[model samples]
Target: MTTLVRELWESGYMHTQDIAYIRPDGYIKITDRLKDVIKSGGEWISSLEIETILSLHPSVADVSVIGVRDKQWGERPLALVVLKPNAQETSADDIKAIAEKAVERGIIP
Candidate 1:
């Protein structure tokens, strides 16, 4: 284990629990692992992707996406959101609508 850790450390990947790819330009693009992915109806969804999309909403201050068991889809994404400061009028439906728009835009499955 020590040797493996040393090898990873020497490679400069650090303690990231994510998969990544190196681009031709030497840019490293990190992606979520299978364990962090949400599988629903044979579609692979990234929780971080959902969170990123939700964070774009003007009223959204913070957000997290998790997988919940679903009777039909097997698993569904549940968004936990916090509203921005002084944004008292935002409702759950409003947040849902923002996510729906992201789906339409192909940002998230």
Candidate 2:
């Protein structure tokens, strides 16, 4: 019980493992899980957000994002995607283009 208590408060806050942000309208929006967040160059990148964006592609049957070690950025996102069986024409570049567009639109960084 004591160990569990310590683990929960190890970060000085209760470890709910939830990542959330407060919008300008004063509403709190829960974004992702802390365990799934990628810490890169001092910025928090939500893996769930990336997966959600990638899943929007017509060819993407399923998608997941995970954090990988990076010497410079500390951590970087690695997307694992599964395309639709009939969408063989969809290339990796096509998937990347979607993410790039999201970046240009300030949707993800």
Q: Which candidate leads in TM-score?
A: 2
For 31-57, candidate 1 gives per-residue lDDT tens digits of 755356788999999888888888888
What is the alpha-carbon lDDT for the whole of candidate 2?
0.82
lDDT string for model 2 (1-109, tens) is 5654565567687554567888999998878765878899999988888989999999999886767667789878878799999998999999999899998998887
Our model 2 lands, by Cα RMSD against the true structure, at 10.6
The pairs that clash in candidate 1 are: none
For all predictions, the C-alpha RMSD in Å is 10.2, 10.6
| Segments of candidate 1 deviating more than 4 angstroms | 1-34
Q: What is the clash tally of candidate 2?
A: 0
Candidate 2 segments whose C-alpha is farther than 4 A from its true place: 1-34
Ten-residue region with minimum lDDT total, candidate 1: 7-16
Which candidate wins on lDDT? 2
